[model samples]
Target chain A: MTETAGTYGTEFFVRWLEAVAEAVEREADRLTELDAAIGDADHGANLRRGFTAVRKALEEEPPTAPGAVLVAAGKQLISTVGGASGPLYGTLLRRAGKALGDDPQVTRERFAGALGEGVEAVSRLGGAAPGDKTMLDALGPGVEGLKVSFSAGRDRAGEGAAGTVPLRARKGRASYLGERSAGHEDPGAASSALLFAALAATARAEAADGTRTDGEGAA
Target chain B: MSAGRDDDGRGGGGMSAGRVGIVLVSHSAGVAAAVAELARGLAGGGDTAPVRPAGGTPGGGLGTSAELIAEAARAVDGGAGVALLVDLGSAVLTVKALLAEGGELPEGARLVDAPFVEGAVAAVVTASAGAGLDEVAAAASEAYTYRKE
Candidate 1:
């Protein structure tokens, strides 16, 4: 397993995005239901549309580099989501892609660092931190845990998303509800958790298929 | 989103070189256009600057679109600058995204932190007077202190 430290390539990213699209499709209703309680009630539908467009764009023009794939997907989401989530998520992916800098393949450690940069960009763009009942709640912890391992990242992201249930919204439209924003998980956090789960799933699939020469050993 | 360019239709000869352009961004297409109209009508300073409305999603729903905001900003940009007044959450974020990307907007485009209607009126009035970007944005921000009481 140590001989096999898996490196991620453009195909891995594309698979991750497709997995995100599928996950968003499967969970859109729940995400939207969560949003209906505290947000605009369109998180599910908006993400569905955005990810669908991303899938289409990726199919029509497959990018050669992992960074290009993420950058293109981010642009698609920004254009199609038609909501605050668009810019926040778009900035995350775009900044991460920029950090990747046309790398055709990256080690897991390098990907984790790039993802950290993406999460930081999101924090700056939304002016929100982990406790703000926003996507950063999930993404911040997820990126941190990714530095340890994929399973650790997924679990931490899920926990961070669930932790938002008790946090009064301090950012985005949910903040408009004031104290009433508590008792609801942030839709953005939920979706972000889904992204991490998809990443984990993609890694698992790649590992099972022996597509990558390196394994998840100690990563 | 809505391709909502209210334009005030006063046939403002061309983009005013010295006057900063104004854009009113809202989640509702009608609301943005109405606000733009009201701001222009209330300004009553004779179409001194272009006031464009960029509102609603591309599907004409009740969400903000970065593409629409970018388009509206470009439409009203007059080489001077563009001052955007956003209504609420996503409107503000969409404009911020465009500005952060530094694309599809004229140089000196700014998001004004002011009340939607009041800020638009003040911004239009000031821009019509051939105010620069700073002056126009300042007038808009000043509306935050406007007291009806």
Candidate 2:
């Protein structure tokens, strides 16, 4: 959204991570408010702290590979972020990182596959299925859309996140609320949608930059 | 994170040889340490088996940290392996993430998903008496059947 370009290398992930950080910061208060309805009301503060550490860690070490960056960020979240979100998100990133291997360049298909692995890790760790009003709901749609196109993936992810509003939570703290969890959006699903939105934004920015470079060459 | 915690000459700080160690994980650092202290009393008082507390974030906030847990796991490991007890959701996930990294655990190390306080006390007491890794883990898991009624 800020016109920052995405590329083939790990830089895309870096940009995506930054975009998600910005998006999360913007939605932090809202996320916490949503949590107040069915969770501990720490979702915003928790992710804010986690992403801040991730940005700091990346700046400090500056990994070359996309997988390395994910692994690094995931590890940071696991240690700095509290609650089940830390581990769940951490496992998602770390597992996806492992799936990507050490490849510096990634194809869209490969990235999609890797993301699927990450989403699966989240599900496996949390034992939450679709219709459970969890992050997986958003991530599941995002991954499927990613296999189609980046922008579509993000759009579907946002829709999936919003769709959780009317569902009853069946996992995490919200599960304790039973039927009361209905009519409220899941904080995890919201944050998860932000992540997919960041990915799509990064991709658009990259395309814009590419067009600019081509025009400059023709000129 | 660093691995292979220094093996103290004091048999892991007064712990007997070949004993299974206990690790306590929680979102609050103070809570984990306090629980460890209380559990130590119930286990065998001070100088009992190696009991380590992995709690909070590196910045001392209320959150679970895989890095801290990994370090604690390494430190608490004796020859017989370690049994880990976690408080809640993220705590369990954090430990699983650390293990999922594919690092070689200390022989027979494993995570036990049981009530933090009760499991830690039970596992600690079992380990202090030279219980095996499975035995210690079982003791912690067995605490799941405990009830206030």
Candidate 3:
């Protein structure tokens, strides 16, 4: 579906969040598998627990703004999950939320900018540049691809996710493995790509369906 | 969310009154529990806002992914909203995916990117003290910006 800017509605945003949760749940094992090869095998488990907690908390109290929801989720990640991932991922969302401000409706450009902020936060937190083989490997390219594709009127979130393969790990637990981390796609990066891909797909679908209003053409 | 009373009353009312909730996403239940505990402790005698944890199911396997997030989206009461905190890159993506799958989340569910340790503490403090979700999110975002500091 072709998603126009600002076409995303509340339902679209919720679905995007759910898609992220599902992607992480589905890949938690793979993440643990990758971590087992280098760092602790708990990456998957750690992430799983964190997301579960987020869901529970949300159930008890729902939010009113997309930015608010993201910020709360990020904080939960940090407090509940340990290690580098907790802080890195937490920063990504918090920064993204802040970039979005108090706007009730998010435009495509705003979403993109917020996500870009998230990517920047991850990179800064991990101290890794592009090609470092960490989540940044996937996130860096994924975000850039999104900007390009979205700017060009195409949604390439899925394509950006697929591009994470072949990168080496340069930071976080996987970095300890050095070249060994290469060849094997970074699990974190793969997941990051999945997140963006889902967002792109959902937004595109929502926009095409005319579910969005105010910011529909803003992208 | 409960508000803490400011002795000086500079906050206007003696009781802190704002709207905000904190969401924690982690790979380890223990870690999430620990953070939640810390947040409660930090709240001290003040009215503690809600701290929700989304992670590992007790029996193993991925319990609730997107559905869980949607559930969380429905929890908060005040007009402030909720802030999400995650543990890893995958966790971040997973939460986002859950949102996508769920379709159209409740209002005020912003994702904050901050050092989990610092962010959690800041969020709890702000939330418990009557800061709304937007204010708390802003505070958490600032925590991330100065994480290294």
Candidate 4:
């Protein structure tokens, strides 16, 4: 199993972004419903537009390297999302892509580490730590889960997102709602969980197909 | 990124050496433009620094765009540098994300988190007076101390 780590190929990345877009589309209204309680109620629409642009950008100038793919997607989201999530998620993918270096493919471990960096970048940019009722709640644990087990990471992400329902908002606009923010799922955390879920599903597909090469020597 | 590279050509030094470029970021496009106008008015309109407004989404929604702000930063950034004044937390985050992309902001650029209108007014006025990057940034920061009890 260790010898068959999934490769972060351009195809995988493209699929990952598309899956995220699909998941966001599937849950857009739910996301907006959650946000309506604590935020501007635009998270769903914002991400829908952002990921659509990300897909369009990839189609416009498809890149071979995984980093380039993510960079382009990140750039599109930064330009189109039009909210705090725009910068937050944009920084996540952009910083993660940068951390991935110029490699055309990467191992699951390496990809997870780069993703952790991306999540950390969000923490730095928003100054929100774990349990802040922000995306970090899910993203932080999801990164850890990835380090442990891809499947476990996915489960942890779901749990982490659900866990936000009881935490009071401490950052972003939701914080302005005070204690009222409790009981409502954090829209950012929910979206982040969906992103991880997409990644996990993609990884599952690769593992089943035996296409998960551990990047033995390419570095 | 290239902000430093273009810092020496646009507004060469003098009493009004390229007014330190000012980018106003807000969730409301109209608010941002209005603030720019108000700041220009405060600057007395004569040889004032460049003030660009980057507010709302491209479609006129209430939000901010990193690309738009970066474009504004580039447009107004002459030789001196650019100072960004944001209206909300997200605005600051967008600027930070734009910088992390490793492609915007002049060498001496700054993101000043001051009260929107006051900071814009003070920063541009200082820029119009031939003040350098730090000086104008200081003026913007001083607006934070402005109390209208």
Candidate 3 overall Cα lDDT vs. reference? Answer: 0.62
Q: Model 4 misses residue A114 by how many Å?
A: 0.9
Candidate 2, residue A108: how far the Cα is off, in Å: 1.8
Chain B TM-score against the true chain B, each candidate: 0.87, 0.87, 0.72, 0.87
- Candidate 3 lDDT over B1-149, as tens digits, reads 11222112224432332356677776555676688788778778346876777655434433224334444544442435668877765456555544432333445567777777678888888888877777787887788677344
Candidate 2 Cα deviation (angstroms), residue A112: 1.1
Question: What TM-score is obtained by chain A of candidate 2?
Answer: 0.92
lDDT of 4 by residue, A1-219 (tens): 233234657777887899999999999999999989899999999999999999888888887778877878888888889888988998899888888878877877888898899998899999999988999999989888988777877889899999999999999999998999999999999999998899889778766865344442232
Show where candidate 1 strays beyond 4 Å. A1-5, A211-219, B1-18
TM-scores, each model vs. reference: 0.91, 0.89, 0.54, 0.92
What would the per-residue lDDT of candidate 1 be over residues A117-173, giving only the tens digit for each residue? Answer: 989888887788779999999998999889998888899999999999999999888
Model 2 chain A poorest 10 in a row by lDDT: A210-219
Scoring only chain A, what TM-score does candidate 3 earn? 0.81
Every candidate's DockQ is: 0.64, 0.71, 0.04, 0.77
* Cα displacement (Å) at residue A93, model 1: 0.4
Docking category of candidate 2: medium
**Predicted structure with the largest lDDT when compared to the true one:** 1
Ranked by lDDT from best down, the candidates are 1, 4, 2, 3
Runs in model 3 lying further than 4 Å from the true structure? A1-5, A148-166, A204-219, B1-149
